[model samples]
Target: MLLVFVLILIVVGLASGMLGSLVGIGGGMVIVPSLLYLGLFSISPLFSEVTPQVAVGTSLLVILVIGLSSTFAYLKQKTVDYKSGWMLFIGSGPGAIVGAWLNRFLSSEQFSLYFGIFIICIAILMMVRNYLKPVVIRKTFLYTAIGDNGDEVTYGYNVPVMLVISFSIGILAGLFGIGGGVLMVPVMILLFNFPTRIAVATSMLVIFLSAITGSITHMVLGNINWTYAGCLVVGAWFGAKIGAYLNNKLKAEYVLAIFRFVLLFVGIGLTIN
Candidate 1:
């Protein structure tokens, strides 16, 4: 029974890691909802009674490990912006702690409902952005960054705005055990005027930072399920590699489209479950 449960977790991790790496979402979106659904019925004595908080915490723990693999892949591609990543990380670190603290108060049903609504909102936003004609947004030249292919890409962003956004991202990470990449990726492209690929890569780095802090807090709070997380991590390691490769291979529009589909699917699943 234990081995069967472990295998199931690994399969979940593989899917989560692949999607997370491709979209910079840190797999929390999938992990949290999936675990919650799994918790509906006891699969085995070794993996019974998976509470919402425990699922969230364990997802964050797995994300911490998955983030490293994703980050390294992005690093090798040279898509990561260290300066921006560091700034975001600074804000996210403390925010994660606060989020974890807040998570203590929510009931399982509340968590599921709210998280479902949030995902639905995000999905709608992405759909609008993708389908609607481009609306001109004001932007200034921030600087140029080296791209993965060794080309210089110029971008701009409002720092004061991003500071607040990054902080909020941390809170989301802690609260939902999500890497906050779903929100960050869109904001980076829309608000910061970053390229889609760059936003995805940089978001992965920030996810790593936030996930580490969030996971630690969850651990201290006794929210993590070590056996489950361990199994997921084993599969995530390999899945991340595949995801990174696919990220580089696929076009930006395709990536966004895929993300949109997943968001819609997961959001509805949570809402109805």
Candidate 2:
């Protein structure tokens, strides 16, 4: 059963990482929902009795690995930018530590309610943002919007705009034990009017900080299920590479369409389940 559970997570990790790489959503969204479906693990409370809080804590541990592998893979692609990514990390790190402690103070019901709220909004926002925009390739690179044609286009906005985005996304990410890429992706799209590819790559860069922040706090809480975490990382690494490759190969709509659906499914499933 333990091995089976690990296998399930590995598969989930691969799918989430690949989609995440292409869409800029991170693996934690999938991790939390799937873990909830899983109930809980070999801990003392048994599966059903283990509170949602504990499940979240455990999921954070696994997501840490998923986020790390994804981030590193994206970085190698030069998709992970250092300047904005670093600042975002600074803010997220402390937020994650504090949020984990706060969760410990909350009751199980409180945790579930908060989690539900977190899941719902992001889901709706993700679908709306992706669906409305037409995917175009551009060579904006670090500037903002992507340029598929030789006519390079860049958003007029600057780093401060991105800074605000980092902080807002960081808080929820800390609370939810996610990379916060869902929120980040849309913000990049609207705030900077960035293209899907840049948005996806940039979101992964931010995940490096956000997930690390959340994961460290979960670790301090001493709730990680390491066995599962290891398997998740192994699968996610390869998955991210494949996703990155596909990201370069596929059209923007192809990735975003699937990405949006995954978020929708995850968001609704978490709320209803």
Candidate 3:
């Protein structure tokens, strides 16, 4: 039974890591709910009775691994925007601390309900993102990158505005163990006119930094399950590499379409369960 449970967790980690890296979400969206569902059912005696706090903390730990793996892979491709990622982390770091503190207040039921609704909202946003016009904000920073086809792509953002947005997203990351990229990717592409690949790559960097702070807070709170975390890390480490490789091959629009569907399905399942 213990072996079976470990295998199950590893599989979950693989899926979560692959999806997380591909989309820059750090795999927490999948990990949190999986932990909750397994705990709710008492799937294994070795790690039974997983609470929301533990689930979130454990997810964040796993996310740390996923982020590191994915970011390393992205760096090799020269897709990451390090300056922007660090700038965004300034706000997200403090916000993550606040969010981790806030997580102590939620019950399992509350966490599930809120997480479900939040995921559904994000799914809806993904669906409509292409149709929505980018908000016109004065640029305080500009960046240029060479595309796969050698065309120069330019993007820019207002630093203050982006910091505020990153802070808000960071709070969500810490609270839900989601790594913040679910929202950040869309915001970069739609709001800041970033190329899809660059946004995805850069989002991983921010997610990595935010996960460090968020996981540290959870560790201080004793919310982590080291046994489970270890198993997840093993799978996620390799899965992230696979995902990063695939990200370069896949079309952004197609990947997002599938991601939206998965989010909606998972959201509805989490809500009703």
Candidate 4:
């Protein structure tokens, strides 16, 4: 059983990490929901007891490791914006602690229902971004927290705005065990007017910090499955690297489309199930 779970973690981890890196979204977008659905009784006949909430928690636990590992890779390339990274940390760090604590008070059914809705919303948002359509209401705020990592220029927009948004991102990270990239990347591009490259790079840096904070908290609560986490990450490492390799070859719009498709499928599955 342990071995089986380990394999699942690695496979899922690799896919989630790699695809996430390519798209500037956190792996949790893929990891959390997939695990939630898979844990549901409907996903597999044998694993009915695995509730969606457990899957969300478990997915968060594994992605913590993936975030740490991904951080090293980004840092190695000198691509991380340490300044912006810290700003987001400063804003969101406290909220994350609070959010993690709140998770204990919530039930699995609540997490599942909320999580499904969140995914569906995210999918729609990604589509809007890809099309360059006027975004009706982006809850995302601004943080003039661009990292100064060499000549690769990225503008920091409205510092005051960013501070507010940054805090919110932190809370989400803590509560959801995400790096807030799903929310961050879009805001960075739309609000800050950053190019695709900088936004993606920035998202990775933010994910590293938020994910580490979240994973440590989860580990303490004993919600993480080491064996399973390892299994999922086996694939995560390679997939992220591959995504990074292909980043220049791909466009953000196309990546967003894929995310939309994945979310739609998952959303439909939830409705039918």
lDDT leader: 3
Q: What's the TM-score of each model vs. the native?
A: 0.90, 0.80, 0.95, 0.80
Q: What 10-residue stretch in candidate 4 is worst by lDDT? A: 141-150
Query: Best TM-score goes to which candidate?
Result: 3
Worst 10 residues of 3 by lDDT: 37-46
The residue-by-residue lDDT of candidate 3 on 205-264, one tens digit each, is 999999999999999999998878988898999999988999988865676798789889
Residue 256, model 3: Cα distance from true site in angstroms: 3.3
Over 1-273, each residue of candidate 4 has an lDDT whose tens digit, in order, gives 645654665677777887777776668777766666455424333343444334545566655555566666666665566766676667666656666666766676566556667677778887777567423333343333334333444355666667788778767766765667888887766776665666777677677666666666766776564544556667876777766656656665666676688887776565444
Quote model 3's TM-score: 0.95
When sorted by lDDT, best at the front, the candidate numbers are 3, 1, 4, 2
lDDT of each: 0.82, 0.64, 0.88, 0.65
lDDT of 2: 0.64
Error of 2 at 255 (Å): 4.6
**Candidate 4 has what TM-score?**
0.80
> Mind giving the per-residue lDDT tens digits that candidate 2 earns over 149-223?
545666423555445557666766766667777777776666656555666776777676666667677777775
Q: What is residue 193's positional error in candidate 2, in angstroms?
A: 3.2
What is residue 29's positional error in candidate 4, in angstroms? 1.6
Report lDDT (Cα) of residue 236, candidate 4: 76
Which digits, one per residue and each the tens of the lDDT, describe model 1 over residues 128-171?
86554433445543768765466886676656667788898899
Model 4, C-alpha of 103: deviation from truth (Å): 1.7
On TM-score, the stronger of 1 and 3 is 3
